[model samples]
Target: MIHAATVQACLAFALLACVSVAYGKPTGQASGRNPSKAALDADQQFDKGSGIAIHKLDGAQIENLLTLGKVWGFLKYYDPTVTSGQRQWDYELFRVLPAILEAPDRASANAVLVRWIDGLGPVPRCSPCAQLDRHDLQLHPDLGWIADTRLLGKTLSRKLQRIHGQRRVGTQFYVALAPGVGYPVFKHEPSYDDIHFPDAGFQLLALFRYWNIIEYWYPDRDVIGEDWDKVLAAFIPRLALARDSATYQLQMMALIAEIHDTHANLRSSLDVRPPVGHCHLPVRLRFVQHQAVVTGIDGTPPNTSMLEVGDVIAKLDGRPPPALAREWAPYYAGSNEAVRLRDIATYMTRGPCDEVPLTVRRGDHELRLKVSRVPLPKDYLAMGDYLAIAFHDLPGPAFRLLSPEVAYLKLSAAKASKATEYIKQAAATKGLIIDARNYPSEFMVFALGSLLVDRPTLFARFTVGDLSNPGAFRWAPPLMLEPKAPHYHGRVVILVDEVTQSRAEYTAMAFRAVPGALVVGSTTAGADGSASRVTLPGGLFTIISGVGVFYPDRRPTQRVGIVPDVVVEPTMAAIRDGRDPVLEEALRLILGPTLPISSIEGMYRSQSP
Candidate 1:
């Protein structure tokens, strides 16, 4: 039925297709027109036998590579069979990047991806594959690029759909489901060998890995206040153009800061240790009311007479303190501007010189002083023994009766088991004061909260990522504090400040579940949820709020922190005078001023009887 000429032409076309695939070349290319010239040149420059120099990529090349990375990471996580237990999927990404980079045009790049996808064998059907765990409530709706049908095509799309079907769900990126019986365990260790700076491949790998994680799993991405996709695009050129180790590290720090999370901070590398230079001022500074205030001085000799406590720092080396804080903010990570400025004030004392010229305001006088920068002492960073002090007067044990009818519990040193004993002791008390002004020595959310409520209460909820559906989040089961027998039916008051964070915030939430529990004081530190460490190239380490934490009603706790029912901020005068206004307010709320001495004495007598 077919002619001899037709058969010959078809055979010739088939042979050309095979040759093109083998050589990674575009089909029907003219002899002189090399579509892959720029890409090939880039590949040649980067591939120097040891590793690819990711920093050497040009703007166009970097864009292409980022696109490739996005698609590659999506498949790596969604399609488990891509690695096939032979090598790590991240390493596989590094392996295939060069081929993609060698494709000069979009069509050629897509062709390269198609070839790579083809080589991934088949998407295996795993009936017992774990369903995605969703524990945090942060959401990112912009990650549609992961499953864009135009990029993935029918075959890969159908494969993903088939995998979804195995889970009894329709094709969706983020799936909603019930909490699993157990938590999913993850290896916190690094999966790659350590490499120094200027190793562009490792740098790119770190950036891509972290970006994908945040893109797919980070719950509070929406609150980040920046276009994360644009951030990724902008950083590609910046990371690629990083000239040295210090610059690269700064770039990485800046990148981490974009999340606007206090938990997100880069651990110092050997070359990048803080106070950022060879020397630092002996004084610790705190940002208060937008002014840099000297808080404490480490016993380094030269500057004790020059700088004093309560002095306001106006300038650093002729630059305004506010401007300096702005300049240095990108180097520090915090949940909000207040925390960022606070951290900046602390770290801004360091410089390359032996002495830093400072302008400080003492009362009404502005004085310029040359403060010597000394090596920070080993114990300089320690939080002093003040937290061990019992709150207010009534203090035999951490938990005691402030008044006969009022119970005071200092959570900083109290244990979980102690909560049970304290509840029994304070059972008949009319009011309970929980001082969470410091970090807890032990977790007491259930142990303490259970004895406060008469019924099971929803304390908080978590929003976690669905790995199968990257960039999607679903609320986990509400965390409830089940009531214990002999529950204390008393009004409760909890204290909080910036010092209260993470477990403290969580504990506050649990206690806040009690009926008529009043949260007093200013906002707590906004960084809540379990921390997940991220290791980068050059042995740099960092952490982030690995989960989303929220009130049962879905009010976000991250960045926003725990808002007080009655907002109260400690005054500068109060700190200087050693006044416990927050605690005083708690006492006022519990014991009215009109209560007579006879009544108080009668209440104490009743307790003894």
Candidate 2:
């Protein structure tokens, strides 16, 4: 239990506030250490830990906890007193947890909940509580659980229904949309950075907090590929029984992967996840034709030829890459299978600094070789070249004329302010290749998009959270690109790959809106929309694509991504020969058969990786 004195301090402080609820404060406080210090901590916050402990739970306990989680989350988002930021909801969970945990049966649990709700005082009937307009809504409040009398007794159910009906209006203290972007800004979510490993109560709190955040605020919950409520039930025992910090983190990663979003992952550190090591094989790998193929070699002069560029890495350290990927899939969060495999391939060869055995296939010959792992290059670019795709710092200026006939612009180095200059420079060219093969340095959605069109063009639309009605989302008007002076009248081709994500994907959607613009490349990362940070207990951090991004006609772009008009994946031979097939295809489309691919002048001189 929370040190008695600390619980006393919390209750003491809560009592000083307006007493509306029936229970003056939470009845249950989890057990923890440092009584005197904890008491002082309680005067401020739950700084030490949630004192609750857990062992094995029976079927009945699981069911009871599931219902409790639903009820707690419902109250958090729906009840006016809680939603208005008047209550320390996390502490309140600690207070009520013990009573529900010890309840003998469903009725007993319901009674405990009833008292908790009653103590929050009475709900006043609002004259104009926000109501959902089905026509304009992309998602509606998921409140069917409130009427589940079989789970919540009639009295408790009635109380919940009343709270939902008169939910808080105006700006909610918990969440708000960004000033103009419309992505959710989770306010006042403390990281609880002091706790290296949280106790059972805080673990349960993490689960409850994350599950509810997605349940109510995630715009694409309908497409999460599984019943989210069931997910909550399944993970409750897993998190509660986690024996150590590593186990807890693994469970958390698995939970995050269930959301099927590339943007959602444990961002605090990569060391926690698989391929955990300080050194890696001195070669870059990319998934080509469903196989891990060497794309680029790195390090000093050696840059090793032991594994040739086109060599297919069938096995690493005697383990097949695919098998390893399968083992790590649950922890690798991604939007779709393509991007999932793309990410897995990036780190499959990373491990200890030792001679790693590898089975390689060169044409028909199968060869075995032991490659030495080296510390990543001291320079960021060299290390990036050795491992994952370069996030920024593409080789040349953002825009330049590849030739009089072809204009090249890579968004990785492009500046939005130079959009006019870029357009003017490209005006005389027959075609412009806007490379979006990496994350853009700036948001070029309107800056460059405007210079490509002759009139207003509809590109994308969005779904934003409804402040008054939590868990509900409405569609915003379609975004448009207004024409700017000196518009480029040339044909357009966009280059993209798995490295293209979020803003890059959004920029592609905007550029593709122009007439005759052709997108040529393999599937993209698929995770669009602005990312919102989610901080959990135990100092863990993650993100969710808060807003739903869609094409103008309401075609979803979350997991499906921006499908290219011309699909062109680089061939193994092309990688071995230092060629970019995707860029070649763009050149082919623009230059036609009249100009030889080799004669494109400066096109391949400073080709970007």
Best model number under TM-score: 2
Task: Provide the lDDT at 387 for model 2.
Answer: 27
Name the top lDDT candidate: 2
Tens digit of per-residue lDDT, candidate 2, span 1-609: 223233223323221111111111211121122223232235455667777888877777777888889888888777888776767777788888888789888899899999999999988877677666677798888888889888787999999888877865664766777655567766656566666563888888889989989988899897899899899999999998888888888888889889999877765545667877767887778888878998767756755648777989999999888888899999888988878887787777778878888899998999999888877544321222112554322367788777788888998788878889888889899999999888676667667887889988888788889888878889887777778788899999988888777777878888999999999998888888767767777766667887898998999999988899999877887777767778777888998857675674337655553
Over 4 Å off, model 1: 1-50, 54-57, 124-143, 146-193, 268-275, 297-306, 379-407, 423-430, 592-609
> Candidates' TM-scores?
0.76, 0.89
Q: All candidates: CA RMSD in angstroms?
A: 15.4, 10.0
lDDT of 1 by residue, 267-289 (tens): 44322533466567777676667
| Stretches > 4 Å off in candidate 2 | 1-45, 196-198, 376-388, 391-395, 593-609
TM-score of 2: 0.89
